[model samples]
Target: MSFTDFFAIDWSGQAVERPKGLAVAHARAGTEAPEIVDRAWSRQDVLEWLEQLARDGTRALIGLDLSPAFPFHDEGTYFPGWEASPVDGPALWQLVDELSADDPHLSATSFINHPHARRHFRQRGDCGDLFPPGRGRFRVCEHGQEAMRLSPYSCFNLVGASQVGKSSLTGMRVLHRLRSKLGLWPFDPMPETGPVLVEIYTALPARLAGMRKGISKIRDRETLDTLLAAFGSAPHRPLPRYDDHATDAMLSAAWLRVAAAQSELWSPTLLTPELACTEGWTFGVP
Candidate 1:
């Protein structure tokens, strides 16, 4: 089932007083007027709603004003840096794909695919299946608990100079698409665990339209930092508080780790035939 439609809702914690003041939007059909359930929903309430949708088999892209996955694990979970993280790209993406596959109409998307978010995942070695295998398509998962697959896909690790607005713009564009195509109004709930295809973009002084390089180019530290610092100064940046800090630290850490790893792999010796043949192999001795 394709999650082509959209829905949204305002989930601001306590600042909004009554649930009646809460706002929700579905693409077109839902109540013309806002629907309020007694009071504001807690995180558990939202999760339960999504669980029901998945059980019922809904196929739609459900947008939330909340951060589905956080960089830091709940309040006090220990996140040993990348060195101890067993998570690989395929493993993480597969989880997200499976978690939402059950809801034929219950799909999800977020505006948090910036370099910061990517870096944080790398630092903690804990990106929970953001990218799935097979040309941006996600697998369907009916079982709630299944082992994750480790398959590589065309994943985007958008790093570079700081404050470039990569996260905010990418997220906003996603929200815009969800609102436009899925008839998603704000303050709505999702009910499925199907696929959610995310689109990403970069921010820079020079135009980056039509540029298709490997993941290495986009995820460079200097470039990400330059962009991030610039975007932070922008008038409309909207990344969450916790995410903002986590992403920044992660991006910085990723660059350092890659640079160190690269240095360790370097060699001063030339690529001679002797070097070409590894030890313990009988080559050209016939």
Candidate 2:
């Protein structure tokens, strides 16, 4: 139940080789401040890094800031009314991967641009007919996050800052590529050895650390270290810049170290077996 390292990824879905929003950070099993990885990373780079972590026999809990699967329980189908929707999270990941296999840099353009699948997403100036009425659907874990006053965006929403739709799809491709190389939580049971990756909403850590909904983003060394201390982590050395991507990665990685000790987080009252397989839960949402 203990991990040698805790890492958080501020992920992106941009089609470019190196996404500007991509960042990664890690905190070892100690009080030392979490460190922002001082390297540029592309989606492919992250995939290779994680594979190396697994191959090195590292015991790590890597939290990915993207939905593992789309809302299944609320609508009972990822693409409601479609006769050929995936049956579970793993299947959905597989579909996204296979469809986007030719997309460069792990991009999911092919899947999102697929004629059958495109109708279910919300794109700029072209809200698909099948797109939901409101802010789109929510998985059980996202609903739990909303219940806590933290805004949750649908993985099917591809427009606006609230849209994580494309990000989730691209992340699913990475997950599919990662299958068997490492364990994906809920979809694949927590492994006793190697690396275990879990879906994480970085805002969860900020909310728990006393930041409000409107301004949960950590922006300054003062603010970041303050929240880091709240997580029982030591003060972090000041970075030359405090971009939201790096700060969120560092704070969430720091928080994961603390969140791992609480047994209740490993089990949630609402996460039933079926939902766990179809709509994976966010790691810190107990």
Candidate 3:
């Protein structure tokens, strides 16, 4: 199964009227550049957009910059000590979907504010105890990323700039809504055809482009162009204002174009059925 196009989304978990951080970009099979699909998008808009692509029979590999699952193994379960803890990734997503069914725009406030479940996440005023400082607050896959020197934060820590907890939780709502329309890598068997979604970390591709630490945001046109060049993509002229989000989305799409061609990325040597079904692995993480 080969992909004819690639997409990458830099998702935002904010519950604002409009999220400026959310960006989408795509690269066609033979295209020399990955173009931004939209300058701004709400979570619902993204969901509908992907569904339309699926309806159109577009066979693309989609990468989302968010953790698809939590640190289940390290904590024994997402909601430890709960009587009805989810058994796997699907169940976990379903629970979030059910909890946030009334949330507008696929926002995950309910799950984030749940009385019991809220204890696992770090909110504005209160920092969750599930992940303490100076100690590891990561999933098994995150540990693997750490081994490679990539600082992948835990999905439960939602306080800092690098934290992905909020975005990932909100992403669950979108994933649950599109589960039937798109195949989720590792969680669902790779379909012989049609669109498929995979969890992506933008840092992986940025690192591949020689991006170094201390430089979290890529704002320079020359630097962005240099990164895109690694994937054979044309340089960006008059680069967009939201360079961080745009570049992240663009570079991620470019990375997917090359990474998807490698059979090993789809088949990690250490991936087990349990890991795939529970703590999802980040695509491109060996």
Query: What TM-score would each prediction reach against the true structure?
Result: 0.25, 0.97, 0.94
Compared with the true structure, what per-residue lDDT tens digits does model 1 show for residues 159-259? Answer: 23222222222223323323312322111222234322211111111112222233223334344444333322211122222222222222222222222
Over 4 Å off, model 3: 129-136, 240-242
- C-alpha lDDT of all candidate models, in order: 0.27, 0.88, 0.83
Q: What are the runs in model 1 whose C-alpha is more than 4 Å off?
A: 1-5, 11-24, 27-38, 66-81, 86-286
Query: In each prediction, how many residue pairs overlap at the backbone (N, C-alpha, C within less than 3 A)?
Result: 57, 0, 0
lDDT of 3: 0.83
Best by lDDT: 2
Candidate 3, residues 75-167: lDDT per residue as tens digits? 778778677779998888899989988887778888888777777777668866654565336778888888877887767777778778888
Q: Whose lDDT is higher: candidate 1's or candidate 3's?
A: 3
Order the candidates by lDDT, highest first: 2, 3, 1
How much does candidate 3 score in TM-score? 0.94
Residue ranges of candidate 2 with Cα displaced over 4 Å: none
- The deviation in Å at residue 66 for candidate 1 is 4.3
Which candidate should be chosen as best, given TM-score against the real structure?
Answer: 2
lDDT: worst 10-residue window of model 3: 128-137
